[model samples]
Target: MCSVEGAKKLAAYQAVDNHIKSGYKIGIGSGSTVVYAVDRLAQRVENENINIICVPTSFQSRQLILKNNLTLSDLEVASQLDICIDGADEVDCNLNLIKGGGGCLLQEKIVASCSKELIVIADYTKNSSLLGQQYKKGIPIEVSPLAYVPIKKRLEQLYKGEAVLRMAVNKAGPVVTDNGNFVLDWKNFDQSLDWNKVNLDLIQWPGVIETGLFINMAKKAYFGMQDGSVKVQS
Candidate 1:
């Protein structure tokens, strides 16, 4: 049986192997699982001598790219990318994802939009039949700091869920994203709700920056199973 970490690595390695190519610009997503993806990317660069440009989705991802000695670029430099290999907080049956557990949803979505294809890689634990079935963190919403309070209140009333500002583990207050926005985790909402419609509506709000509900964005996904196998879904 594959441990959780092993499964993550398996999915990461396989995704990198299958998606990445020389001369291609790539989007590096943020999160713990993405750490393993960077590791594999570094290995391939070292062994295969493949030259690729990395566009980081967060501060953490930039650090990973720098640490790995990978050539790092930005959207301004490489706005068009070949593909994006990312990890999802939760991947549903239709490949809809609940991302931004790391507070990088805004940038992640932007980079993914610039890319031609979005590839999601994850462990078995993150693979679910429904959006909130396995991941309990809820949908992450990036909002302007000045309007977070009002946005949170409005969203809570609109959707029956505990909408709380996500606090930092080491910092004093709310988790400020790389783009300097606050995050609200809408927890325990109706799972059967139409996320596509909700996401469209939420983004139109005054203070909302982005929502974690990724619909029709990902082209394919790789799930590393506990039984030491990889499952490809498209």
Candidate 2:
């Protein structure tokens, strides 16, 4: 494996071994990094016989659970989760994260809210002192398809950044989220602004579903370093 891929695997495996326990309900997150996390979870179930019910945060996550032959539950059955292990686009020093680079932000945040603790697993390149310092994909904003234009214009006017519809490379139109909502990548925003307040404000707006900004949510983060050591930040 390449260095980055190796790092991601290391972090995911470590996070699973450290946080997951027998008879606990876990929230599975989306994206490439999470793929490794699921692999580790499946291994633990098979080798150690550690039984756990997995609650998926996205369609991709649900598929992963099924493909791994791990027991799967929905929010209705498992409203409260023991812990959530997810990946981030960027993780700041304060543990703030910019997620949803893969259009799974809405469900990811919902599942996180239901979990007791959130553990972010990532590669070293995703760690930064600020949200936009390393990751440049921008804050993903899941919005109503009908009001995307107004929300885009309003966000640009207030935040002084570009909000573009995320397009699908393989598909013909914009990238539709699992919730069937369109995503607006609000890039180049003022990094100095209070993200906590910004997140609250954004959620209250009409046609706004959820933002990629995960402020004051994570309990801790584990970053797989280039040298193959895992770095833990809380």
The alpha-carbon deviation from the true structure for residue 52 of candidate 1, after best TM-score superposition, in angstroms, is 0.7
TM-score of each: 0.98, 0.98
Q: Please report how far candidate 2 places residue 191 from its true position, in Å.
A: 1.5
Tell me the tens digit of each residue's lDDT in model 2 across 86-189: 99999998999999999999899999999999999999999999889888888999999998999999999988889999999999999998899999998888
Clash count list over all predictions:
0, 0
Candidate 1, position 55, lDDT:
99
Position 47, candidate 1: lDDT:
96
Off by over 4 Å in 2: none
Clash pairs, model 2 backbone: none
How good is model 2 by TM-score? Answer: 0.98
